[model samples]
Target: MSQLKEIIYNCKKATSLIERKEIGRLTLRESVELKIHLAFCSVCRIFRRQSITINSMVKMLFNDAQQRQTKLDDTFKKSLQERIEDKLNKNGKKL
Candidate 1:
């Protein structure tokens, strides 16, 4: 594929390079590519905002739950843990 097409396609990959970027870091090349993709791809742009909002909500909820240490319960904790694990695994990182 052409470089821009590849970049757009890459932006669509995984939770999206843009989304993965919020939870972690991206290489210089990947970051540059994503910025380029976001400049033009409206779909990825929307996905970018959604990912950021989801992350913010999760962090807010998780922090509140942690402070209370009462309302979270096992299911919520387990689901959050699984989501974290999945993200890490997809990124080839380890906790």
Candidate 2:
């Protein structure tokens, strides 16, 4: 039926909105349509939850790493340059 088809469409749209949380509020028609679709669709519900969980975990991990610096400092850089120059001079290279 046309009404059933409309319900399915709304449900898919709502799942997408829930994933992004950008849909403020649905009209009465949209609310009814989404409810009907979600009532029978378990996969969409699970997907929305899992996406949230994974996003949160990744954000936390990134925040922790952001507090640490992994690169060498100026002294280390100078030491590396000296080693390279010494090796090059020993080989009679201009660089």
List the global CA lDDT of all models: 0.78, 0.73
lDDT of 1 by residue, 1-95 (tens): 89778776664463467766887899888788878878878887788788789889989999998888766688989999999888988999754
**Which run of 10 residues does model 1 get worst, by summed lDDT?**
7-16
Off by over 4 Å in 2: 9-12, 22-32, 73-95
Summed over model 1, clashes come to 0
In TM-score terms, candidate 2 sits at: 0.51
lDDT of 1 at 93: 73
User: TM-scores, in order shown?
Assistant: 0.60, 0.51
Q: Model 2, range 1-95, lDDT digits (tens) per residue?
A: 69787666665586765654532666677666666777777877777678788888888989888878577798999999999888988999754
